[model samples]
Each structure stands twice: as structure tokens, then as C-alpha cells.
Target: PSSGNKAERFGTASVAVLVRHKPGRAYISPDHPIAQEGAGVVLTCSAKPPGWPVPQYRWFREIETGDIKSSVL
Candidate 1:
């Protein structure tokens, strides 16, 4: 729905947000210094303070040309 649509009858709602929980560094599993050519790879990415509202993972690989290819999940 567009913001222009009125919801006056809906009244107001209270919300609370906490941002004090500092997140720990992220880590990757099955880290390979150099991956084999044409080999299927499966890597798991995770971060500390794991809970609901999980963080999205973006996989990136650097080709020989020093160019990064990224895929979003």
C-alpha cells in the first residue's frame, strides 16, 4: 500500500529496537587457499550472535584476473 493511503483509524503502535548488541566477526567454513579447478564447492558462512533475523550471505570468488565474481543468496 502507498503511504498516501490514510490509516488514521488504525491509530498508533509502539515499537522498541535495540542496537547495543555488538556483532562478532564473521567466519567461513571449509576455507580453501586455492580451490581445485572445475570442482564443485560448498562453503558455509556464519557470524556470531546467531539468532533470528539471520544475516544474508554473499559469496564471492576471485578469478585469476583479480576480478571478483559475486553471488547473492
Candidate 2:
């Protein structure tokens, strides 16, 4: 009976558990009226949690034919 209790405790002790977490992506986009054609415009984009390093940016234009043009900064 003592041996059975020891075995149960050993079995429980041998189990291992772990937890992990990863940072999520942070991104921002230009506000509405992003730009106006044939007029002076400023395209602005930024990342949240200020001071993120080397963030990538992309701008898209919607056309009548459902096509998109991508611009990078």
C-alpha cells in the first residue's frame, strides 16, 4: 500500500505543463480622405505603441475594375 502511494505521487510529479505567448503585429493606416487627385495631398501612416522599429507601409488605390495598385513608402 505504501508502494502504491509512492508510485501515484511519482506519476503525478513526472507530468510537465507549459504556456507561451507571442507579441502581435501592430499597424496603422492613413485617415479617411487619404489623398485627393489633382490636388495637394499628404499620405500619412503610422504604427501604434509609438517607436516601433522599421515598420512596413503600403498604400492601395481602388479602381472601377476592382483592381488595386500598391504603393510603398
Candidate 3:
């Protein structure tokens, strides 16, 4: 009340937030690389994540045939 000795009020509130994530894709630099005999080559690989918890990567060498390719040690 305007003229009352004291006045008080009650209040309540709520809030929310949402987070989403998606899988990652990987790519390699120098898409197609080749090295000469008695020479060495260096390649870099990376991945992009749409959300938190960054992505990790592993590398494997692939050998190619006339019409097919396979990963080898």
C-alpha cells in the first residue's frame, strides 16, 4: 500500500539455453601428392567440427591400381 509502513512483493523467473553439435569432415593438404625416387614427402591433414569437442585424425597411406585404391602400411 502507498501509505503502509512497509510493502513487499514476490517474484519468479526461469531461463534456458540449447546447444547442438554435428559430425566433422576431414581433408588432406596437397590432395594428390607424389615424391621422386630417393626423396621424401610431407603432408598435412585436418578436420572441421561444427560444434565443441574438436575432432581428431589418423593417417594411412593408400596405393592405387588400374581401377581401385587400397590403404597400406
Candidate 4:
């Protein structure tokens, strides 16, 4: 079959596999801090992406006893 006919046949098919290629891993830092823990301390994380779901974020603080305090938002 000619290439044109094959293309037409595929187009007429009921089901098709459409592959969408999208970029990943976007990171940004705002000029102003989102929050302040103590005096002269600030924390922030930012990013922008199209058609992306809400990301899972985690924050960790290391203690003197080699233990980690984790906070997830």
C-alpha cells in the first residue's frame, strides 16, 4: 500500500496511541521569602509548568543527635 493510503487508514482507526512529550523538573526561587523561621531567616520554593499536577514537597531539619525532623506540605 502507498504511504498516503496507510496514513488514511490509520487516521480512520477507532483507537490510536497519542504520545505527548512534555518537559519535567521545573525549579524557581522567588525574590521574596515565603516564610520566616526565625530572625533573618527565610524559606521559599517556586516553579512553573504547563499541564503538571500538584507536586509533593518535603522539608527536613537535621538535629544534633543525627535525627531528622521532616515536614511535608
Predicted model with the maximum lDDT: 1
Give the alpha carbon lDDT tens digit for every residue of 4-70 in model 3.
Answer: 6777999999987655565478677789998898998887766665345555555555446454344
- How far is each candidate from the true structure, as Cα RMSD in Å? 11.0, 9.8, 7.7, 8.7
- How many angstroms is residue 51 displaced in model 2 relative to the true structure, after the best TM-score fit? 6.1
Model 2 lDDT per residue over 14-69, tens place:
65554443324554444465556688666566545334344556677777898775
Off by over 4 Å in 3: 1-23, 62-73
lDDT of 4 by residue, 1-73 (tens): 6676443333444676655544355554556556656655445544454223445446577879998866543
Per-model TM-score on C-alpha atoms: 0.49, 0.40, 0.40, 0.34
Clashes per candidate, residues 3 or more apart or on different chains: 0, 0, 0, 0
Give the Cα error of residue 3 in candidate 1, in Å: 43
The C-alpha local distance difference test score for the whole of candidate 3 amounts to: 0.65
Which structure is stronger by TM-score: 1 or 3?
A: 1
The TM-score obtained by model 1 is: 0.49
- Note the Cα lDDT for every prediction shown: 0.69, 0.54, 0.65, 0.53
lDDT of 1 by residue, 3-69 (tens): 7876556567889885555446788886764568998767788878854456777777687999876
Candidate 2 Cα errors over 4 Å, as ranges: 1-30, 34-37, 70-73
